[model samples]
Target chain A: MSTVSTSIAPAAAPARTSAPADNTSFSVDFSDIGRSFTAKPERGAARGSTVAPRPVLRDVSLTVQPGEVLAILGTSGCGKSTLLRIAGGLDEPSTGSIRIDGSPLNGIDARCAVGFQEPRLLPWRTIADNVALGLPRRIGRAEGKSRVAALLELVGLTSFADHRPRAVSGGMAQRASLARALARNPGVLLLDEPFGALDALTRLKMQDLLLDVHAAAPTTILLVTHDVDEALQLADRIILLGADDDADDMAGGRTGATIVQELVVPGGRPRDRGSAELAELRGRLLAGLGIDRHGQARGVAATHTIPHFPY
Target chain B: MTQTQIPKPGTAAAVRPARRPIRLTSRRGFVIFGGALLPLAILLVWQLSITLGVVSVSQLPSPAMVFLAAIDLYERGQLTLYVAISTQRVLIGFAIGASLGVAAGALVGLSRGANVLLSPTLGAIRAVPSLAWVPLLLLWLGFGEQSKITLVAIGAFFPVYTTVSLALRHVDQHLVEAGRAFGLGGIRLFTAVQLPAVIPSVISGLRLALAQAWLFLVAAELLGASMGLGFLLSESGGNGRIDRIILAIVLLAVIGKITDAVVGIFEKWANKKWA
Candidate 1:
């Protein structure tokens, strides 16, 4: 009963699959995304608690343009997620306003869909059903069924539609999760280390797939990652987090900490990892992290700079 | 504009549409249901032994005699009437028990207050077997159909209740979070997400309740019913008509098996439809 097909093959949805829309416009916007934690950075509670509150991000501000893939590069702790949460409208900014498409965001809900490191699929449903989970449940049965089938098509998973999530490989499962998030037809896609949990080969495939989908949909994406090459290869502009020479650093013995260094990728679309431009970007990034040519830090980046990551 | 369209994959080639319910319930299904040939061959051996006077005719009637009695009962519509009566009782008792049990189970499973308040009484009831309630039920309801229905209800109740509640308890938390993330709230969460999530458990409970009802109905009917299959079994035993007793036993086996098959198919259908 749905005769809503358009002349352009922009993809149909009273049929299947969901993704970003061009006419439904938005570019990422944020002003002040802060999260605070009161920690006693002491060995023991001294004299009934000499602990103080810390502002992870004092008043972070950022804005991204349409078609731009903004990569937020931060160490394990520099409030990247907090900034993303505010930008995505999933969490309220501590003190400033956030607007996407010139409209203010208020609360828990956001206009964007995010892919977490974990592909949190519903175990009870099949891969196809999981992808279609975001489709409206109250629609007519015929419309709903067709939409589900179509969503499966876009995700490159029409074959595994009947297979449960547990029955699939991790990469395949994440693909399904991406499809599920895309089903919301968001204007912006937030990816929080979506490839952080994948193997190298599969992660490359996913990155390529993401690039293809981005080309097709033109969604403004904000990718959060700890990998420098990943940021350099994929981002239109990268925001570095850690060192802040503008402030006093001797208090906690943090000499050269994570700092924001915006680097333009010089070209659009997914790039080859070892290009000369990438090498230049990597050198710039390593310089930002305060690591010497020998890969040793010139000084402690920060006390919080962990020696070795278990991953 | 340059573009490339990659076709997605699927399994559509060898898939054949099946006739919905007939495969499960046609006449051919009854012909060899549960290796009937082997059981029939055993009955033939029994008949041969009887003819050779291996055991007293008074102790056991030949299979042929049981078959003739079954035919007679069928002709008089007594078999039909009894099957209908038992089926009705089972259905009615199942309705009461499953609905109430599922409701109570869901409440107990989802709400801390309900679990804390109602667990003691439910645990006590579940601990006792349905047979133990026969005498008490007879004394309370006076050998009427209520006693039998109540017994069936008890048999059906505990299994469904336990399964549904346990199913609710074990639902994947991510799915629940997804439901919440979708902006589903209030009654919508329970109806759309929680209830559907717990369906496999409910179906398992329903199948269990069906099996229990068939097995328990006979014992429940022992409390002096006038015209149920259990009553007929009692009367046949009293008269020592071994053939009629054997026929009743065969009838119970067939009825229980048929009901169980129906419920199993239903559970499968439910999974496919809602899932």
Candidate 2:
């Protein structure tokens, strides 16, 4: 058992609503985001010629209502992670801009906390100390310690407080990562495939944990993932990036992803795991990726059904 | 069938459990005895060779004779004094060399400009043998304690420098990113993340440097030293006191092992704590 009292207020519980109640919730706005990297020209190019920039994302625009769970679904190399990074303020878009809570984001947005694909826990530090890392220096030591204890308890890892990360299992470490991210009490949480590395059982459990966490805090979430089921399971809205039809726009250069489909997931928390609507949404997401159950085009609505498999 | 059944009444089919054997000795006792076996065997062979007159007394002394020589030195208060002198010289040399090496390594590791400017020279210096420092140090510092200490210091420097720099450069990238996400930067990042990460590597380097320091102590004492084990060995050789020479060599080996064991314990503890 942790030294913290059980009455530490369950993480500022916000009512489950479509819109943020007031100024307490943070909103994210991505306006015409595009990113590119310059690639050197191959041999035999003309002298003094400027090489073209390889576009990873282009014309991506979206908005996350405060306290909404928005899952960005895309295949590999579709720049979903890059978009998340841009939103988190760890990266800058080559063009366009992002605004958080009606304020322009220039550097790291102190109100936003990011959980990466890897747990990224410091190996030398105890699990408790690693969780404490999320708190800013402004938080007093006693306060920070209590907050860390509360988080460890919330994550069901209070017993392992003194243990180093190497001593824990992978799923436990990922839970610790979640606890660390929440330590800042950020209004916006950005997760990049946080459960991608776990097994099937662990992934399902983690999804449930994420829902529990969101219910307790009601912070806005932006999750980037390739897993269709995961998006349908947790998201209030799903945004599909890098539609197959957009490839022609590049004309043999580099093609970037854009928001091709925006979906509003119906129903509420504790929804059926094998719900028919979720299965339909999963099918639709797969079809949006230009593949059907038989790996063929879905109906006659598909022209560029075969996504370009990058060599 | 009836006769066979009746015959089993005196002999029970189920055997009683065998009484446990009485304990003969503890495992540690056996381990110590096993460890001493090879040394005892070698001593026996050495004594037997001397008794059989296979080696002349002038050329090689028996184990008993060396024991007498050790006792003689101990009674004269010379053994402890010389050992103390040699130990102190090595300790001081190692302190200077190791501190400088670590400082230089860290500077090079943290700054690209420092690495580019200093690595070439340091690498070149590392290639120079420990024995090679004796002459230059003698010429520069003259025949005194300074030259001897410098030789040992040179021996201790290279390993620590190499290990520290390499470890610093190879800190896990993910850990750095994690630190940055938490608002750690600059010196705070280094202390909180990088320093602890490199401790295990630095410990290994210290162990290597300690061994090298011991190796160089003998060479260091070979230069114009009136005391210490190395000087004792040389002086005893000049006087054809083979027993004393053998005792010095044994003492050096035993001391080296003891020091290395101490560092080994530290290494194990650090690895368990940090790794």
Candidate 3:
């Protein structure tokens, strides 16, 4: 075990030194991001058929400033998770480039940590060990131990440090997951519906916990959620991915997901829920999601009355 | 959905304690007592039938006759020697076969390359019964300890290998993704995530393999063993000592049952730990 720790020490050394400067150096840039795959044709289409390429994400361009919380909202099948995965360097975009801290991302983005929808805790390991997984290899044992303890405390899972993931509640498990993500002290934190599976009450608690964590860490966050209210609550800006307007622009009768609308939230942290600004923006965002209360294509028009919210 | 407080429908019933089920640990004595009842009743019927001449004493000896035969074998020191010899063979064979099976299963389960190269060949060998291996093994290794032990090992290997490999393949995908997200790859991922996840299944496989090992032991000893319980059984059959044959059969069943119970205990513990 000593030998194993020593072997990993050198590989993780740079990350430890670079972590403190995270907030200033952190930014995520997604330029002309496009991903497509060749899938088999639908079952009823034809026998031995070769279908056109299916594009999941297309022309998704955005720059997330350091310490900013950007929410990507869309319905299922809109490739919002795919966009986050690409940003995290888990998957590569077929058409464009992603940059982290102004450098082009080539492989797994060590500086960007991801929290998936499921808590994704390893069932065998204790919560601390799962959290310790993100610790850089080069850090000494003492430092790693301290960091893990601190993170568990930060996520309010100090009592569960020695407990396995299976022994903890779902909300607690997700908190451990958040602690694990923060363990690396990554410059960019990519969350793909981190609270989607929780109960409404638990989701609210987690959203509050996320706010507290951000206040402490101040890292750039990219949250992917379908919940309009959640985006209004947590994000400084919200981007919607959907089909392009022009039928001619859509190949194979349907277009890939793109950044069709962007909304800049008006209020600061801990804003009132009953505020009229948020209420009107919520209506416009809902309309953009194709649920117009007026029963017409008035999504763009709805946001015009909200003076503070910018597109 | 009205909030009227008129004893709120099933509130009284819901608040009442349901009938408490007996816990397993607390019921251990009861379980043992219940289990012994059937065998005791069978033994009584056997003894009564023999006394009444319902079962011919020559063909089907009473339970007392078998007990006396066991004591006779014990006095001659044959009982201990036979049991010891058979047990040593099983322990050695099980150790060898179980280790190899687990290693092969891990290799094949974790690697598509190993599965492609080795699965078809292993699958064919696995299909061959323990009895089928007896003749070939005897021809190769002779009517000695080697042939019998090898036969037992072969019987034990297939179940462990097949169950473990299949279980490993079916490990939850969500856990695998979690491992990947945490910078775990290759061997680390397998050990930290996949292996622990499949431990319950592996323990179940071990229990099955152990049972298979014992089944093959009898077949192996019957073909050629000079001092095993199986040998005793055959020798008694030739000598027409029906009681001694029954004694050997009873000993085999008792040992098999005890060993299976031991493995079952481990299986239960593993499931609790890894559940």
Candidate 4:
């Protein structure tokens, strides 16, 4: 934890100069957050029938320090994305509140910028214009233009500024999406599987790019991803969300997901992927997600070697 | 390796050099010539039929007779007046109708309350043949430009309204959400996301409304009006002058095609910009 804090300090320092006043990284607090969605009635069901409210997230409480990168790790449908959405104010919690920098979040909080899994770019707009959409309403035209240009440069998409979203490759489009989210200099950036759609090689490159972006902006990041290696790679802290078996039994079965495991990743920015420590943590996280390690845990050498090519 | 590299540019030059120049001028000329082929063939067949005496001259006048009728109308100075009046009415009616369609479509498309309140009644009104509005409009506004233009406007409204509202409603939800997330709402959101997303559909709607405008113009002129192509057709029919009737029809076809071509050009530009 101390190492993590020391590592983030250097990155957070430059963020103050780069980001607008009072718009730098802000702390996020999720206290007793619970969200329930009413299940749609089945077809041919009687009219005016009341349906039970299905809980998706219950009692999800966490406090993220400013400039911290927190990864919410969970399997699909485990309400991790829901938690991130609640923090971004894109979705409201049924119970409890989310406070950003000590202020309670309201509808679509301006302090938070969300990068959705899909690029969600306006198809007609150029990459530059799409990024400009994130500019604050009061920003001057000249300042906004420079900000968009700077963001494109940051994302290494300056050459493709005039290109439409469909004209670019998937990785390039995702980079533009990230740049757009950063255009507002968001106090808290919520990323929901931002690179989930990319090919493996591109995903690795994007993860590195994200680390660089964090170093530059250092906004409080809440990333929700199902990829355990991704969590190990990018997070200062990793929180695993899953159903508590005992609590689930008491609630009659699978009520909602809450924090099941939490770990302070034992390193700074750009941690070594091949480290034995992370391999153990990865095995543990995969187990938490009900995935078998297949004798791949730390200190367990493979009995059979991978065959060489052209063998 | 040297031979491959040397031949690469040779092949590229062979493929590229003539393609652009050909596409620029001669290809376009070829397309235009191809388009005219059918009409020219029809003209030949009509002239041959007349020369062979396949049909009576009184029933289907020779192509020359139709040309003479057009010249007669032009010499009398009525041809320009008729075309001018018809074009003016169609343009004005289309403008008023398309503007209202966009306004109403945006309202209904964006707001649930507006959609619920307006769409049902508008849909019902659209079902009524626009020609049916003529009798009521004549009663309300009398036998004047008001009644005729109103009929054309009615004709132009539905297509634009339907297309605009549907397109706006179906503008990608993800894009709208992203727009909303970035502090855009109301009119800013509309212009930034919703409007541009649906521009192709709106232009298509405008084109359909223009065609409908011409259709309604003829309907209005056929029932009333002292001038215009429809008036010319009806008057010539009454006088048993088939040539004049045929001339009015050819004039209507040419004018309609010209107007549609104008909108088609605009559509091409818009699709390039927005789609």
Candidate 5:
């Protein structure tokens, strides 16, 4: 593993230092984005019975600058993935529009590439072939080949290029999926819990690898994750999404989740995991998600009682 | 020797039996021998029944008599011609039917509009019995190779179409979405994601269609043909040549199995590469 990282270090260096300063990354702007899904009718229910549409996200608006790593943190079913999907053009918002690099986003935008929570690699194709699938259609054969090789090298998957998705471990497959998303050299990278399915140790390593990739390519990244510490460690800014406090009392209780809090993480890339500032922010972010830092609500003093051992 | 000491050459430890590798060819030979046991026993019983006069030779000829019939036909050069014609018809009809099946299947599988427009009619057509079309085919194409080949083609079409379409419909939706997210659509999506995903099912469908081809082949030949195994069976039956009839039946069984085995090889290769 040390040898693998050493090999990747040099490849990432040249792209960062030697490439001309012409920025390839694009800013993403979301204006009043909202999405609603009609509740699926119950099985054997009366035909033509109308089910009310369930609001998932409403009035979400944010702008991510080019080269920024913005983490959208939320609880499950809070539409963080939905927001990322909207940014990548995988899903469209019903109420508002998105613009990438000042241009209105259309269906399946070519300027953005997505890495799903699952690796989502084509099982039949080799890792290299799967990455090559992300190459732009107009790319020349030679350029596409070299681009795929560079991406495999950057992700430390050079040796496993010919292996299929099922033949590799989950971490390796996710790396291949990341390489595939990078192969497009997109202006914006939308990662929806790309490391969520990995083991804890692998997830940490993948987070470092993602930072390395961002440094090398310098593209705007919108990451959706539930891990508060992950957001603290990776993002330059974090946005918390959830339903408002009085959402139930507003307009027949049909209110959807919206941006509740936004904070600019106070540190540079590769922030210390154990730093006091990040720990405080982690506590705050977790509290926003309805989890108490010490298993008790804020503004309450707790008395510690030691367990009496019979021995 | 001490526990840490390495074993020297010719010592008991050094000479201990190495793990034996399983010989694939020998295992395959065992399987083949095992499979042939029942047929050999049947052959033995058949010969014994003739010797014991348990059945009349006119009704059920002995194995030797069937062998003699084969030899008699071989000498006249008609046996080779019959086998060759039957095989040719099956191959041609299978190829045509399978090609049409894939084309129709892909259309129906990929496009919801196409599925809605074509599936009902095709399903109804598939429900018609294999022999039911014989009269209409005869009337349309006459008593020639065309009618026989058409009948066989019709027999081979339905399975391939059904399996291919169903397999395509259930292909991993996540993989399809990933392909779309990477800017693939239409023909590109089908080739890169959908086609390879369904290859195993398509090969299995082909195997079924090949078997169906042979079935329709005999039907076509039995109804009307001058130079095939089915024709030989009918001709022999008309002349009360029980030996020739048994010969034709054996030939048909062997050839059908051979064709199926050929397709089985393809299925194995496809599964390894795609599945």
Candidate 6:
């Protein structure tokens, strides 16, 4: 446990009670990240299919700056989740590099937190107990309980704090999960479609909650999603993923295949949600995603870079 | 939908009442009470049927007849002596068997390399039932208390091993990865995450192993030894004292019930506290 504390002790900025650092920049450089393995998979002596495990991710490289949310937009089966895992140190790439805050990330660290699309709260724990799980041991039981109370309150789940995960609604479970991720006071958050499991209204509410958390901590966040409108609404920049051998170019290291271009916007925060810039950007991303006016997939598609211009 | 409030929204009173009588509808209490009633109901019916002469006197004795024999044995001090002998054998055997089984289960579960090495050997050992071990135990340890305990240990070993191994194989990959990511590996990972997660399954296995221990308890006693419940049953059977035999069988049932209840309690406590 102390080793974990040491591993996450970033020299650039200490973890803070409220304000971490006045610094406004953070960045990650993932270079040539890839992985492969081999296994029999079956456990029979008589007959078993043996095959060389293939690569789940290739030399995927990207850079994410601090206080900026990079929405990684990708289609299913294009290894978006795999890329996210590699970047978070949840997976070791077969060949490549990953640096967070200029320090190499070899394995999981306390400075980073990840939330999956599924609301993966521990079933046996109440919402508050789930939140307390990630808190540092120095807090002790009483303070840990209080910290859990505060996080649950922040997530608008004070009433459900004592409720087991099984008793809560899907939206409530996701909120509890978000609160758990927040408990570690992470600097870099990896959200894999954090609100994908929620209905539209709940998703919007979760989006607002996420934005507020970002405002409070001002942490560097890398959010992944397949939804183009979501990218337009939340990200400082959107990197579109395509299923091609040259997909590494859109990530800023290579240039061969890209459908939706990567473009950086100049916005700091609090961009107008209903402004024409956002709407126009949404339309372009929607087109890139091949979604039409009826909120359905479009027949026509185009590859134009996503820019972070604020109006 | 305003649905959250209509449910008589109370303070955390819903979960806090530590001494509150658990609702019968709640699964925990229901299982507890239902479990308690089964044997009592069986005894009541048996007592009633025997009193009514519904069964032949040779085949079925009234519950009272067994109770009277138990009192007679108690007065003679045979009950205490036999019960003590059986209890000691069970405890020692179960301890040895469970520890070995857990060690083997862990070895099998963690490494593919280890599984390939151990599976065929365990397969042959598991195929041989505890009853089949009686002759070997008598030959190995002599026809005394030692043989009896060895039989009980063999009975306990296989179930614990099989269940623990199966549960380990099906361990949640996500939790393992989470533990690894958190810098927990080698021993710490097993103690904190892997072990806790596998506990519910292990408890079930222990429960099964304990029942097997009881199953072999009689066989162990019957094979050798001059005391214990199983020996008492055989001794009574020799004299055609069916009432004493029935009493001993009833005693075995009672001990089995008690051990099961204890294991069940431990399982519930483990799941609630750690799981």
Identify the superior model by DockQ, candidate 1 or candidate 2.
2
Q: Which pairs of residues clash in candidate 4, taking residues 3 or more apart in a chain or in different chains? A: none
Best by TM-score: 4
Superposition TM-score, candidate 4 onto the true structure: 0.90
How do the residues A153-232 of candidate 4 rate in per-residue lDDT, one tens digit apiece?
A: 99999999999999999999999999999998888899999989887778889999999988766778999998888888
Off by over 4 Å in 6: A1-25, A34-59, A136-150, A158-163, A244-260, A265-268, A293-311, B1-65, B272-275
Off by more than 4 A, model 3: A1-25, A41-51, A247-252, A294-311, B1-26
- Candidate with maximal DockQ: 4
Cα lDDT, model 3, residue B122: 99
Using TM-score as the measure, what is the rank order of every candidate, best first? 4, 5, 3, 2, 6, 1
Q: By DockQ thresholds, what CAPRI class is model 6? A: acceptable
CAPRI-style grade of the A/B interface in model 1:
incorrect
DockQ of candidate 1 (2 decimals): 0.13
What's the true lDDT of residue B22 in model 3?
A: 36
Higher-lDDT candidate of 1 and 5? 5
Query: lDDT score, residue B185, model 4?
Result: 87
lDDT of 1 by residue, A134-194 (tens): 6544557677677667767766789999998888999889998888777666666788888
- In order of lDDT, best first, we have 4, 5, 2, 3, 6, 1
- Cand. 2 Cα-lDDT: 0.81
Per-residue alpha-carbon lDDT of candidate 2 for residues B1-275, written as tens digits (9 for 90 to 100): 23332323323332322133212233466667987899899999898988999998878888988999999999999999999988888888988888888988888887788999999999998998777888788789987788878888888888889998999899997887778777788899989888888889998998999889988989877756888999998898799899999999999988888888899999999998777
lDDT of 3 by residue, B178-256 (tens): 6776677889888888988989988888888888888899899887778899899888878899999989888988998
Per-candidate local distance difference test = 0.71, 0.81, 0.81, 0.86, 0.85, 0.72
Q: State each model's TM-score restricted to chain B.
A: 0.82, 0.85, 0.89, 0.91, 0.91, 0.85
Model 4 misplaced regions, further than 4 Å: A1-23, A41-49, A250-253, A296-311, B1-26
Interface RMSD of each: 3.7, 1.4, 1.7, 0.9, 0.8, 2.8
Candidate 5 positional error at A300, Å = 16
